[model samples]
Target: MKSLIVNADDLGRSAGIDAGIARAHREGIVTSATLMTNGPGAEGGGAVARENPDLGVGVHLVLTYGRPLSDPATVPSLVEPDGGFPVKASAVIGRGRVRTDEVLREYRAQLERARELIGREPTHVDTHHWVQEEPGVFTAFLELARESGLAARPLNDAERERLRAAGVRTPDRYVREFQHPRAIDVAALLALLELIAAAGDGATELMCHPGEPDPELERTSAYAVARPVELATLTDPAVRAKVRELGFQPITYGDL
Candidate 1:
């Protein structure tokens, strides 16, 4: 029994990204998405989610980039003076500048913002740049999940075990592309499917960033051009056929 979740991250970052996520869910093997409440296209992302109820939208709680959903004055330890979040994960978690209390408040704010924008609770919660994987931050985030009764995206065996022990929901297996531009590698994905099928017994997730190329995305991320290629790979019929051939069921976090 192998289930695969092709969950795209950075929804609401820009118009291009929003469109790409929507298309991937509608036309490709993508089953879910993690929406960024503080992103530039947040309102658009919420509207898109409402339009496509099957997408299984979740909150992409961010603390490492862009602006903060909580007032900057209120979360001073978490944001820069200018109100933007630090681009480096270390500045917040590693430096210990962001206190546990700040994380609790900001994370709840982001979750609430997501609910307000999406018009419903998210199916799950994950972080921008895997920020929740950091030491003190991870503990705080786990607590939030427990309190909210929301599933979380745990990337490794240890984290999975920790979450499960805490009575939280998560996938059984996690797949990440070691190569840069992970989402565009259809051949690699096909091979991965073969590998997972051979192993045979866990729910897994494949995280991706697929989007249309746009000036805003280019300015904000180094990942701009790779997005369109990723979009192409995800929407490719051959890739979907291969997924079916391998007998991997495409699912959302809701299905976990």
Candidate 2:
């Protein structure tokens, strides 16, 4: 049997985003989402998660785009001179200044923050900007998942092998192209469903960023305009019907 987990990322980035995620899950095929615990809308996002108990909420761990939950001083290698994270993942991964210990500490803090706000353990863990794919960071990320006994997102087959070898749970495949603006349409989504159906057995994760764009999102995110388009496509009844037609068992990360 084939299984699919449609996980929307960046849930706590803004109120617009939180609203979009809620709608996507409630009226669409989004079975899971990853929360940006440090984002401005985190508290509201947590409320949404609680209200929708079936929505699997996970930690969208950050090494970029916000201040660290751990004191900046303690995670100096992970932050900039101004105590905020670099705006891009490259700034953190390419600098070679990141400390594995610091990454572990800061990630733990974020996970704890999510637990506190959501009033329960997150269903899984994934990264913002895929930062955890970096070599040094991957070690710490894998360690955290193992320790926390949480499912994780693996960007590729190698990462999947590593996570499995480390006794971490993860989907068998990951699909990331669905979030692009050009692909945020019902036809594209239906095509994606067909592709997943053809891939045969094993669970697959389709990563998406669906949200209602707001002024804050417009200012902070370059991909803001594509959000509502994704939201609309994701919430379309046709997409949900296609999943059922293709015999793709919809699942959440917690079910991995």
Top-TM-score candidate index: 2
Best candidate according to lDDT: 2
TM-score of 2: 0.98
Model 2 residue 254 CA deviation (Å) reads 0.8
* Candidate 2: segments with Cα more than 4 A from true spot: none
Summarize candidate 1's per-residue lDDT along 1-256 as a digit string, tens digits.
8898888998888999999988988899889999999876899999988999888899998898788877788888888878889898777655756677888898998899899988877889888888876776788788888888888899788988998899899998877672354535777767776887787877888888888778877886788878888888888888899889988888888888
* Model 1's TM-score against the true structure: 0.95
For model 1, the stretches where C-alpha displacement exceeds 4 angstroms are: 178-183
TM-score of each: 0.95, 0.98
Q: Residue 103 lDDT in model 2? A: 96
Q: What value of lDDT does candidate 1 attain over all alpha carbons?
A: 0.84
Give the per-residue lDDT digits (tens) of candidate 2, residues 63-173: 887788898999989988999998898886666779999999999999999998888889899999999767889889999999999999999999999999999999999
- Candidates in order have lDDT scores of 0.84, 0.90
Q: What is the alpha-carbon lDDT for the whole of candidate 2?
A: 0.90
